[model samples]
Each structure stands twice: as structure tokens, then as C-alpha cells.
Target: VSDSGLGFSHNRFIALIVSIAFLVVLFEGASELGGGMIKAQVEQTTSKFHPEKNAEDRLKPAMVLATEANIDNSVEETSEAVAAEWSAEGSCQQVIEGNDMLQFNLKEMVVSANCKEVTVTLKHTGAMPANVMGHNWVLTNNTDFMPVAQAGGAAGIENNYVPVGDQRVLAATTIIGGGQETSVTFSIDSLVVGDDYTFFCSFPGHYAIMKGAFKVI
Candidate 1:
């Protein structure tokens, strides 16, 4: 099952990369096309009003394109900063993001076993309410993951879809909606290094896609 999940994650990652690349190509082409169209229109207007001047002399639309390019760069940088903030791992603190798409931004999380306590932050980046597209971070042994998740479903959203007072729940965060964030901290003393662990969402029908491997080293 773990292997299958890994395979699915890997394939999804590849698909996402490909889709992003395609989008980038389309966006660049559209930007260029738009700039060219605007420049041509400006040049035509200039030539029509002042035919004595050459086409090169009337082409003054480059400034607008330059400004647009600058704006694009700024937006790209801001996006990278947000992604960096959420992708943090490899320490005592881990950050993860989920959206209305029923997906987690990461397929694996790792922490150092030396840390006394570990913190996990879950950020919902979509535009949905908690009842519709709620997400939470749940940690359990690999063997207990599915069973706990199943029981959690019966426990309802009031319990963050986690089985109440269940020892199998190593850690879990409260369910959150779009634009909301929640976190949970658990002691690392109960965690064993090199053991099979898994993290998932306890939301009904979401565990299948919103799950990942958890590792301690």
C-alpha cells in the first residue's frame, strides 16, 4: 500500500510539473502576443496621426511591456516566498499546505529524532469552508493509519475526525478551512526512528489522497 501511494504521489508530482510548464509556456506566449498587438496598434495610431515620422520613431510601446514584465517578476517572487514558507521540513517544525483539491502539498515529511518535540502546521490555501473541504494533520503508525482514519470518520467533524481519546492517534490538528491554519505539537519520545509512520487527513473521503509518509531520522 505504501509503495502504491508513493507511486501515485510521484506520478501526480510529474503531472503537476508538466501542467505548470505548459501553463508557463501559454502565459509567456500570451504576454508576448498581447504586447505585440498593443505595440502594433500604438504604432498604427501614431503613423496615422503623424505620417511624416518613421515606424521606428512611433514605436514607443516598449515601456508598457517592460512594466508588465517587472510586475510578472514581482508576482513570481511573491509566489516563491509563499511556497517556501509552507514547504519547510527537515527539522523539529514541519509545515504543510492543503487546498480544496483534496491534496497535500507534500507526500513525505521528515524530522530529526533528536528533537524532544515536533510541531506540524497545516495551512488551507483554498477558498472553501471547513465543512466542505476541511483538512487536518494526523499522525499514526503505518499499521494504525487506515484503522484510525476509518474510526475517525465515524467520530464526526466535532472531533476533528479523530477517534476521541484513542491511543493510536499520535498527534492531530483541528480541522480547518480555506484561509485558515492550525497546528499540533507532539513529543518525539513516543516516536521511533526508522519505523514506518504515516500522516493523513481524517476528513471523510479525503484520507485516500491527503495522506503522506512520515519519517524520523
Candidate 2:
């Protein structure tokens, strides 16, 4: 009876050690699996914040930047070309005469784009005063002539029958009467070739019969 009891205790001891060893190995395996999962989750979260990690995302910004830069360059080049074309002349000069019959001596006035400064002298050979037969030389685009002329009339004779601070009036001379004269000097660079320009007397009722074409050569 004593020997059998000792053998039973020894077996129980060996069984307990084996069970403990198995439990240790299982815990270790589970720890390793959890660590791998955590590492994978951290990598995925980092990738979400860093767009450069994806090939398409990385290229998108660069392409957009290049396209915008190209468009700006194109606009700048076009604006420069237009400015150059508009100012391509050297220097020139002209004269015009107005009379009491509400007429300018010339039906068509020619100007040179190369003229650095153009001086237009208006000699009014009429016998009436400015209030009766006022004459002023005004220049503008053909399309704006009539409208500007009408506006000038409303401005009244006190303001030289010319609209005040009007940009549409490219150039103008002060109103003058018979035996009197007026002149206007302007830069040639203000003119554009091929543009239809007209010169007229902005003296109330005179524009209807006292206007003519202005040409730039």
C-alpha cells in the first residue's frame, strides 16, 4: 500500500509540469499573433495620413501645378504680343481747318503711327462767336463718335461743349469761334492701326455735318 501511494504522487507531479508547459506555449503564440495584428493596424493608419504613399495621389498635385503654370504663361505672352503690336510706330504731324459754314476743310485726315507727337491746329475762319457757331476738334473710335457727340452737347458751351472726364474722347481741342484758333497735341502711341477712328466738331449741332474719318497709317 505505501509503494502504490508514492507512485501515484510522482505521476501527478509529472502531469502538472506538462500541463504548465503547454499553457506557456499557447500564451506565447497568442502574444505573437496580437503583436502582428497591431503592427498591421499601425501601418494602415499611417498610410491614410500620407497621400504620397499612393502613386496616383503623389502625381495628381504635380500635374495640377504644371497645368496652372502653363495657363498663366500663355496669358502673359498673349498680353505682351498685343501691347507690342499696338505701339509699333516711330513719329509724325498734321493740321486741320474749320470755317463758319460748319465744315472742316478735309473730309479725311491721315496720321502716321510712327509719329512720336502729333499737333493738330484748328483755324476757325468763321465770323460767329463760340456760342453761335462753336467748333471743337474731337477724336474717338467711329462707333463712339455719335454717342460722345451727343453727350458733349449736353455738357454745354461753358465746358467747351466737350464731356468732362470722358475717356471715350481720345483727343480734343477747346471750342473756338470765327477768326480764332485752337490746337491739341497727342502721342502717336495712343493710336491703333486698322481701328476706325473719327474726328468731329462736338459743338451741339455741328457734329452732324462737321465730322470726317481719321486714319492711322
Top-lDDT candidate index: 1
The residue pairs that clash in candidate 1, if any, are: none
After the best TM-score superposition of candidate 2, give how far the Cα of residue 80 lies from its true spot, in angstroms. Answer: 39
Off by over 4 Å in 2: 1-91
Instruction: Point to the candidate with the largest TM-score.
Output: 1
Q: How far is candidate 2 from the true structure (C-alpha RMSD, Å)?
A: 19.1
Candidate 1 lDDT over 1-217, as tens digits, reads 2344555766677788899999999999999999999999998877766756654555657767887797567546755664465432446888889998897877777788887789999999999999999999999999999999999999999999999999999999999999999999899798889998999999998999789889888
RMSD of each: 29.5, 19.1
Residue pairs that clash (backbone atoms under 3 angstroms), model 2: 90-114, 91-114, 91-115, 91-116, 92-115
Mark the 10 consecutive residues where model 1 has the least summed lDDT: 81-90
